[model samples]
Target: MPTQQEIELQAAAFRRLQKHLMEDRTDVQNIDMMNLAGFCRNCLSRWYAEAAAEKGIEIGKEEARELFYGMSMQEWKATYQTEATDDQQKAFKTAFKENVGQE
Candidate 1:
């Protein structure tokens, strides 16, 4: 089992990464991010919702998405996202095949 301190440190690092994704990479499309990182903002939001459910907390998908996106998800889409090109879509399929169920 992991030590409490290690878990805390890991949680802190995850927070930093989440903040960077939310604040610094606002222009990066989630599809591109998933292609590169194997997980996108929506994946994070889903995991957040799952965690809440595990703890008997009721958080809707939209609530989790807003928490991760730092705005309404639709607002984020309208403001910073572009439709993925064919190449991006292809790369995403490859990435998902390589990364599925690893997290």
Candidate 2:
């Protein structure tokens, strides 16, 4: 098991990664992320929700998304999301299945 300090460090690293994705790299679309990295902002938000659940905290998906995004999902999409290309979508399906298992 990790020490308390290790847990804090991991949290700090996660926050930095969130900032990098949310603030510094707005041009990187979620679909493209899933295609290449098999994860995206949505996946991160879902993981956040799951983590809260493990702690006996009941966080709904949208609420977790809002908390992680610092805004509503609709707002984030309107502001930064782009439509995916056909090939990107195809790649995303394979990546999603491989990484996330099923739809």
Indicate which candidate wins on TM-score.
2
Task: For model 1, name the residue pairs that clash.
Answer: none
> Across residues 14-95, which tens digit of lDDT does each residue of candidate 2 receive?
9999999999999999998888888999899999999999999999999999999999999999999888888988898899
Tens-place lDDT digits, model 1, residues 1-103: 9999999998899899898888887778889888888988888898989999999999998999998788998898888889889999988888877875533
What C-alpha lDDT values do all the predictions have?
Answer: 0.87, 0.93
Q: In candidate 1, residue 16 scores what lDDT?
A: 94
Q: Determine the C-alpha RMSD for candidate 1 after optimal superposition of all C-alphas.
A: 3.0
Q: How well does each candidate superpose onto the true structure, as a TM-score? A: 0.80, 0.94
How many clashes in candidate 2? 0
Q: Model 2: runs farther than 4 Å from truth? A: none
